[model samples]
Target: MSGLNSQRGVGLVEVLVAVLLLSVAVLGFSALQMRAITATDESLVRTRSLTLVRNLAEVMRAYPEAYVTGSGATFTTVLPTIASAVPTVQAIATSIAIAEADSGDSVTIDGLIISINGANNCLSTGTTTDDDDNEIPNKLCSINQLAARDTLLVKKTALEEDIKLAVVSCPADATQQAIQQQMCIITAWNDTKALIDDTDTKACANSDGVYKIGSHCLISEAY
Candidate 1:
């Protein structure tokens, strides 16, 4: 009887150990599931934020001149002002800030900023004094021109690829014609020097010729 009791006690102890082990495993699995859920939520938020930022960028790019000329109030009115523009602009100013603030995982709210300084160009500078005794410089026109060209080229290339793919997949489709026309226009605008000439002489010489889309000389006296 004593030996039997000792064996029974040992069996109970073993069973209790097994139950404890099983409980730990279940808890671990629950923790993992929670972590996965959290990660997925974070990813979704980040994607939404990125989409919002892109929309904001498009708005600014659409009206590049307006962005340069408009006041803070104008910007707020043009863009969705649910979040202030100043904070959004600050995040874009620095790479680190962009990385840190852009993540949807961050508890802090994210924002978009469009900063356009008419006085300072993205390229090089020329020194001058304004009415307020503030020294100013004209930004390098060449760099801006090149950047614009590059942007257009990238867009054109992507559009051409899509058109080619569509045409291949549907040979007789009328959509191909529109894409083809667009491609031709892009090519003409990019390749024609008369269209993008910034110098006064070129502008004067090409006054009667076909100019590029948004050519400063053709569109406005200030550009």
Candidate 2:
């Protein structure tokens, strides 16, 4: 009878050990699942960012004229290359997009679409004259041009604190001269993680908009 009682006690201990191991396995699996979901979400956000970058580049390529001349105040002026991609430009575009998306916010703000010279603003605002400007002859809208048309939110996408269009100039042979400029564009977004770490960033005193830390993605292209 004593031996049988001892054997029953050992059997109960074995069963409890097995249950604990199973629980541990289940917890590990749950943790892995959560990690996978986080990775996927990050990937999705990155993809969207890339798409936005590409889209802006294409837009720039199409309208090289808009970025020429006028302190960028009148149009997307072609100031000396400060950096590729202007922070203010990216911020204004994103803000305008979001505002347009939100029904309630749409009315209070002037629409992103603006009229130039009292005319509906085309993707290209004015033309680079065939004779004086480069032969491309396509025109760009200047800041003053937009003003002539309507009130704008950001006036040539300029910001007091947050804007610098990085550009690199290299000596060009004949073909290179045609595509002489490498322009930089930065796509910046508010980084919650960065904001959380330094709460004082809420002020953004140095920058006109939120400081996203490394959240900006800059792309430069010669066209």
TM-scores, one per candidate: 0.30, 0.46
Model 2 spans with C-alpha error above 4 angstroms: 9-12, 68-180, 188-223
RMSD (Å) of each candidate, 1 decimal: 20.9, 10.7
Candidate 1 lDDT for residue 78:
26
Index of the highest-TM-score prediction: 2
Candidate 1 regions exceeding 4 Å error are 1-10, 68-223
What TM-score number comes out for model 1? 0.30
Name the 10 consecutive residues with the lowest summed lDDT in model 1: 162-171
Model 1, 1-223: lDDT tens per residue?
Answer: 8978766645777889999999999999999999999778656544443433343334224323221112222222223222222221212211111122222111111122211222222344467778998988754433223222223223333233221100011212223221111111111212122122345433312333335343322111101
- Candidate 1 yields a Cα-based lDDT of 0.30
lDDT of 2: 0.38
lDDT by candidate, in order shown: 0.30, 0.38
